[model samples]
Target: MVTRKGEQTKALILEKASKLFNSQGYRASSISDIMHETGLRKGGIYNHFENKEEIMLSAFSFSIDTMSHFFSEAMAGKQGCMERLLSIISVFEGIAERELFPGGCPIMNAAIEADDADLLLQEKVREAMDGLLGMVRNLVQEGIKKGEVKQGVDPEFVATVFISTLEGALALSKLYKNQEYMKRAVHHLRSFLAQNCA
Candidate 1:
């Protein structure tokens, strides 16, 4: 059985590993990197996780949870589908401005790195993406029910466009080392929503 102290140590390792993996990418971050960040020896890490893959899985969960909390906080006072959806973009823009995760969105980073490799990591990314898509879809559906959004709008299509646009914009922003890409994407998204949503 793992002791309370052991659980604390494991959580610490996961927290540090999440940041390191997000900044360095999964394959680029080695055990030594995690050890250096967490100040734990190999034995300590191994005592909690069976391997690096195990650590990575936990770290990804940590990253996703953190991102979810950030979005929730951003959406707290916002109402309606348009407001909630725009809040997501606003949060992403804030993340870019503040360098919240160092490298960028953890899910996007992991998805790009794990594509065509690391099936397990890829699956985790897919689940995270699905969760995000579902959130957007639910918001849109709620808006339709409340008469806040256009009755004919397809929640699935809107969610897809919103997510894909943001992801693509984030990638370009990171690639070009400029926030304008994200800002422009947000502007276009807002315009699209204004035209489509009520």
Candidate 2:
């Protein structure tokens, strides 16, 4: 029973900390902030995590899992590469609309926050992004293997372009607090996929 309660407390800390970190830049969010967010004093938080860095790592992992869950749900019935990729775009659009992960993309936020200053966090961000890009690349490859996408289409190029476009548009949308940028991105990506991937 004590073990279960401890686990519960740890989860609570992670949930609140992740939201706090995402909303406020991770580097700017202090231990005091996390303590306040979790409604736990220093000891209470330290009981679960050794330090701010540890909490940041765990919270970042939690964010990645949360994002992945949304993607999996969006792609549930999607079969074709274009279909799956569009679903992915819809997820990004949903982000711009604040339907998910309210503070913005975790990977993007973390990358900007930790760039050049925090080696560990930077590595984590890179790994997360690689996974995201790989997912797109694999989908494109599958499309070609099934003859749904044009022969000789470069999955590598497609993945890079696909993610950069969506992330860039998402950043713009977030900056303007308008969903139009994401909507425009989705529009162009759909057409790009249909024409180029065809």
Candidate 3:
């Protein structure tokens, strides 16, 4: 029973920590920052996590789960592959507009920071990215099967282009503090989807 309660507390800490990490880069966020955000003492935090890295791993998982939930929610009730894909783009636009994570895409954030620095975290980021790309590829393939997309269209190539385009747009949007970049990307992507996928 005590262990169960401890697990719950740890989960709560992870949730809070994930938001902080997403909002502020990992290196910029410290244990003290997590403690402050969670209203837990350092000892309380340490009691749940072995160290900052452990907390970060858990937090990254939490962030990914949160993003997945958002994607699922946005895709719900949308019919066909193109609609579903556009729904994802809409979700990204919403995230940028509302600062849903307050620091743009969590996967991108961690990937940029963890590249060649932390093997474990980098692996986790790579896995998350792979899953995302797989989702896009699967959607494109499904569309082809349903005769919604061009039959000869290469799903892997489409997925890669789609992911890279959005990531680039997101980076530029965040860097320029302008939503127009994301908007234009979405528009162009929609056009591509209609022309090639639809």
How much lDDT does each candidate structure score? 0.89, 0.90, 0.89
Candidate 2 lDDT tens digits, 1-198: 459889999999999999899989888899999888888899999988888899999999999999999999999988788889989998898887877977889889998888677889999999999999999999999999988899988999999998999999989988988888888888888898989665
Give candidate 3 regions above 4 Å deviation.
1-4
TM-score against native, each model: 0.94, 0.96, 0.95
TM-score winner between 1 and 2, please give it: 2
Q: Could you tell me the lDDT of residue 77 within candidate 1?
A: 93
Residue pairs with clashing backbones, model 2: none
**Top model by TM-score, which number?**
2
Candidate 1 TM-score to native: 0.94
Compared with the true structure, model 2 gives a TM-score of 0.96
Q: TM-score order of candidates, best first?
A: 2, 3, 1
Q: What would the per-residue lDDT of candidate 3 be over residues 1-198, giving only the tens digit for each residue?
A: 459889888988999999898878898999889989989999999997899999999999999998999999989999999999998898788777755777788999999999676999999999999998999999989999999899899999988999888888888988898999998999899999889865
In model 1, the Cα lDDT at residue 55 comes to 91
